[model samples]
Target chain A: MTRRLPDPRPQVEIVAGRAHVVGQQCAACGLRTTLVVSACPGCRGELAPVRFGPDGTVWGSTVIRVPVAGRTPPYCLAYVDLDGGPRVLVHVKASTEPVAVGTRVRLRGDSGGDLVVELVR
Target chain B: MSHQAAVLGVGTSSFGKQPEVPLAQLAWSAVQEALSDSGVDARGIEAAYVGSVLGPFGSAQRALQGLGIGRIPVITVENACASGTTAFHEACWAVREGRYETVLVLGQEHMSSRITGAIPPDLGDPEGRSGLALPGVYAMAASRYMARYGLTLRQLAQVSVKNHGHALGNSRAQYSGDYTVEEVLASPLIADPLTLLQCCPISDGAAALVVGRAAARRDAVRVRSCALRSGRAWGYRSEHAWGFEIVRETAEAAYAEAGLGASEADLFEVHDSFTIGEILSIEGLGLAAEGEGGRLTESGHTALGGPQPVNPSGGLLSRGHPLGCTGVAQLAEVTWQLRGQAGARQVEGARIGVVETMGGGVAGLDGNACVVAVLERP
Candidate 1:
């Protein structure tokens, strides 16, 4: 009998085998943010959690050549502008392919509760 | 009449590596110079505000403790790279509100002692945990800006060439040499589209300024306005990268307070921590229209002798970015220019100038903090 481990990130939920990201919208000012907080960042109003799509567009990207801890060199980082939601920073899955602005992307999450983006041609 | 704050004197230590110097010693160097330059005794300073990014928790108290300036109120400011200017802003407020007759503002940083390359964002931040370093973040913005505006890489490299060329006249600059656009393009790449020549070096240095009532110093420069703002949270819509919105709003507020417009300023000293950073800043500050900053640089509109000269003191690109020191250093350069003391690189007959400095990176937010200050010759 294996004990079920609690998810590490509060903003991420595992439904069946798929992962979905969550955020909060202010009850007063309509301000939205990716982090889970009791009060809204804008108006300090009560917030309710809302789920966002696993799809977004690559607003911008960069190829980092410098060595980073626990990460491979030359990995891509992108600002993924989600559909009907706020932007998020995620690691691009492509190792060799170049990423550009406005490239459509599909968000994917790992068991570790980390999000990454896959470029859609 | 509202109490007014005037800049009595300004001082800056040579910016670059100084591994042998302690943080307090670096601060003292600038403080002593400022005291001498202002012809004001240390005993006259009623309070002190110190700014630093990586300095210890009690760094401000430690900086003023051993100096024998008595037990005056001392406070430390930590607002990322904007720490220096933020300290200056607080000092001005103290003088304006009549809480203190005279105040000392100091900024110091020792970047060369520990880390290298672009500074990392806070580990607890979502973006930082995603491994978004400063260079990578700027590169992403640069890529989007270039694509949106049809800017060429050659045009972008020209900014580095121009700033490095400007640095050749200043002895305090970190990296200074006349280089062509090709040389800039050929330099070792840090992030895609950004090369070694385009990034600010890790440096150690300090700067100091004295703010007092206008009647206290007849030769002082006037602090027309100083505006500071933190980033606003993202709403339902996604915004552009690089925090342009905050820059614009802060600049507008500063200009409104000063009763001036962007076109009225004869010179600008901005945070050019990266070549692309300057492009974004100038545009957001209204020095150039959107998508026109690169073109403005290429056309010589932002050159030393141009109509709207910018970063005549080499900026952070070549003058070195000692985080906390960069902001106050900009004001010092402006003060010199306004006083007609900037011998070689001065904007001819500069009477009005503006300084803009920004700092910190939090994901999903426009920016952490942005400061805009306007100054005029008294």
Candidate 2:
């Protein structure tokens, strides 16, 4: 007699998205919200599609001491609220230290254009 | 609104790096102990939630199915280290929602694989992809904290020493060896300001609890109020990265829910993912004032036998951070104490306990999935 083994995989599928431009439009008023993506996070509206600009400005920043993926410790993580409609999480390759919030930045997409991000101003 | 929830039973598997046991069996050890303690069998369970940060592939369903508890719906929560408490919050909420009479909250994980260098999913996120591994992440924060607050590495080492002393008596702890503050500082820097001894070893452990709406008996422990909230951005609030100042906001809400102030809580088990965590958490939890946690630890005010005993089970630092099992493990210690069952590590006259679990990556979860529960002696 032969026996079968269960699939060695998880039931959940978690994906990693790269930096890329994604649209965020409003429904009720039929007007575009802020250049940033979140109209209302707690209770979101029926968001529509509107292409964003490739550039952005750094609104805030933080340096994590715990484990991360791409860069090493003392690396920079920033909150870049873009020109079009979404605020993206990104890294400033140039310097991990001494970068202030509100630095002008250009929204740059990763190689695949899936995860949209911004570099230093 | 103070809700009356009691911990009827508490169970925990031996905590360490155990690849020998399957994930399900790890959970099973706690389940069996809890069921027997609560005097409630699997049949009495209306719902179940499992908290696991790393379950080695489909461990939740696999583990639940073996115990006959799979018949009840199982929802697994993964909030990094807070995963287990996140499960606890959900189980308690189910009872609060009146959807389930008896709920089982289990936090279990096996991270022995880290012996070969394991990178968690957060590192896979693009943010982490830029490096910033656990040590790097917290160390970076600690470095900045030192610059701003004039903190020292010795104070951080003392945090580890105090907990190690506490763990010497906790059989369920991941680490129990006693180390001096000097030994902690000499343990080699995994990250600046954080030495090997300063950081918690990745562990494999399981802790389980059986909670119900009934009143706790003399031998049972009651949960006066349970509260869990996610991190939210107040827009330029900057509290997310700053310790305690932000977490304090949530602690206040939990105390208010219990109709008691911070002065009433006797014991605390917080998410001490890093040594700095304990410093900030104590203050954030209102056990100390802002920027005063370091002073409290130096003065031995937060030791196991101190004024407000913190992390008597050695906490995540000495107990081994099995991620999912930590929060429930904290609950296990509290339940044991309130019921007068903590053996050598018990806190005398302990009542109105607090188990604060801050999960997920970052100094504090920046408004992502977060939860906290406050339990009282009722």
Candidate 3:
């Protein structure tokens, strides 16, 4: 609508979590971006980049029958809502079977060095 | 109004998972149409710009080989869904820059290959190396928009229904028939707010566009502007800051260059990779008021005969997305509309048209790259 107005407030802090996600907060509007972002897409606020805090419940998920570039079929992926409230989409770490929506997931790094979510304790 | 980009010719092939037809054969069909449409010989052109999402080894040259279009300098351009549009941009640029008078633009894709099935080991930096897929990225975007805006699943389903109906009239589109909103809602939910119908199908096809400088009558549509840009500053903590917001930002510039506002444009051909994407694109490009795109769809503003007809060829929704051919097809569709060539799906007395094609790996906040162009017949 409005040309991506700048993010008036920018906040990002990398912290410890099962799987890390970038944290975000707006200073001007006090809007909290549930996921780590570079800028406030709504406002032109420059975001402070950081890692995600782990311990999220599955907001939703699906097993991808569509294969990855070099991977096998039935790749597990999901959107996890952190215990702290931010939601992020990610491929759950490797497992033998598919993933379900609402599965409790722990965060961890994947083979490529990106933060990943997995079923955990 | 005579800045000088004429639609010399255009061509397109039926869209689908036609693995039976080799990639070159797919390109050849569109290429031949463009040459014949413009009434020009293949050798009359000095250069070529081919847009493709995924091509197997010198694919454009291979496709042209069948047409005896060898010995001409050809370059492949890849810009995700905007691949075709990107090709158009380069051809127009060549004309504007006064390098060549006759240039060919093409957009094509062949997703039926192994590329669609496996992740490229060199997809991207560490972020992608860790394994991030497009569906999840868009799914995340859908989730955030729904949660914050209170957009309902029913509203999202309406998008698929509307687009499905639009595609029904497109003889070249892959999706057919009318679907009820309820039926869409009842379809399998691949993502939280997105159903299977909401997403565009993987396709293999190509489209050719012939745009060059030529004197014409007052009715000729000139290439008003083809503004391409990458990166916009959006401040969101949870937003995917990885890719650029090229579509919205570039569309803004393109509108300015065209000496018009988004409202002045009569029709739009945008990249509807996912149905929700259409909503976001309209809002992002200033075509609709923010938080009002979905409502516009519900209100029938994006229908074929509405104030603004979007994706008349069923867009990527009904029209199959062949990477390289998409942009050419979009331009051809727009040209036909401007020339009053679109039959059943034609927007009566249409004059101005705009196209938005954005592609690349899905990131946290926005599309990776994009190209937006504005055209008019005066």
Candidate 4:
């Protein structure tokens, strides 16, 4: 018989036909982070699974014009600060123009298992 | 039996794309020069510490072949880009603790043979798996910095122009040109707000240093202090950029140990892996206040002839970055400057110099590691 190991941290999930990023919230400190961790980095408290955003603010972003590790050129990568406390690095859906920092974005779906976000407007 | 350590000799292979040179050959060139410079033969070295990020396993042993150093301990260290300086730091500690009277430190990398484009991020990392490369990471920081401090595109391009101009005098530098801000901006864009010139070129090179007890040489450059620290977990509430706090913390430790302030140093060889990196590094080293690095660069205070000349050897931007070799190369440049041997790029009457190298990137942390060292003429 073969046994499969469980993965506690799931970066993305579809809820009610909308994709949302998953994070952990510390029970003691109430700190939330998208980074996978067993214990709270802030207070070493027990953590519970939590879902964040279909909506967030772009903390920072860049247009990668060079190819890297099989990824094509001219794709935008951004750090999105979700409506909740967690922040995540995700790929922004390529648009006619580059995404601006502080622009509101919403999670569209998953692209190759990586979260994909789009401009809210 | 404890003694203070000093850098008795330094050497480096010319920095550039040299796919023709093998890793061992590249490393041996630097090792031979360093040994000869110190007036010490291969047999005189008591132990060796080699730093290489991407070289084959047992690279140190391979590089030391036919050196006739016997069966002495040949330890290897890999701390990402800071590997070279970390090796130097370890060699100094061994000498200072009296475990070895003299030790050899070498940092080598042959990127052309191994990497073609941008250095790939660790796929194991969540961010790296999300299609984030090194340039993308720095571009994000540049974006945030611009949003917060109103930094202009011209100010960022000036760093590339300044370093490339400084490289004109460095015979061993990989790239050198009298580039205007407009020219720098016009270079192909690798990432938004950062052009190809702003990013360091991948090259092959090696640097070596001989570390011994300070009393061993009458004209030795004393190793005032070497501080190394790993990044701490940074929350969203943090005010500074990702790697800023670690550099600051490490520099503070180095300053306290050296018994000198940032103002006392006449020159600095900082890790300018990217144009934005130079600004972030200077601020982290206390050379400028937070968010003031752009203004400081624009004011030309960190230029070759300014009050505090930085990267007179051209830095990683113009000098070429060969992963593990960069830190050792920076130290070698500092050693040369202190000895007044740095030809045309020399800072007149230079006495004190600082070398800082920060390395690695991981999720949830400011940086992987940082090494800061203070050197002074004795």
TM-score of each prediction? 0.94, 0.77, 0.79, 0.96
Off by over 4 Å in 4: A1-10
Where model 1 places Cα greater than 4 Å from the true spot, the runs are: A1-18, A28-31, A96-98, A111-113, B235-239
Each model's DockQ score: 0.42, 0.09, 0.13, 0.47
| lDDT digits (tens) for residues B107-212 of candidate 2 | 8888885444435434224334334355544564565456556567778888899888889988778787778878998886565567778778878888899988
Q: Chain A TM-scores, one per candidate?
A: 0.76, 0.55, 0.63, 0.85
Candidate 1 vs 2: which has more lDDT: 1
Cα lDDT for residue A69, candidate 4: 75
What local lDDT does model 2 show for residue B250?
A: 71
The runs of at least 3 residues in candidate 2 whose Cα sits more than 4 Å from the true structure, single-residue gaps closed, are A1-121, B1-3, B113-115, B121-124, B234-246, B362-367
Q: Ten consecutive residues with minimal summed lDDT in candidate 3 chain B?
A: B235-244
Of 1 and 3, which scores higher on DockQ? Answer: 1
lDDT of 2: 0.68
Q: Best-fitting candidate, measured by lDDT?
A: 4
- Winner on lDDT between 3 and 4 is 4
* TM-score between candidate 4 and the true structure: 0.96
Deviation in Å, model 4, residue B255 alpha carbon: 0.6
Candidate order, lDDT descending: 4, 1, 3, 2
Error of 1 at B327 (Å): 0.9
Score residue A48 of candidate 1 by CA lDDT.
Answer: 89
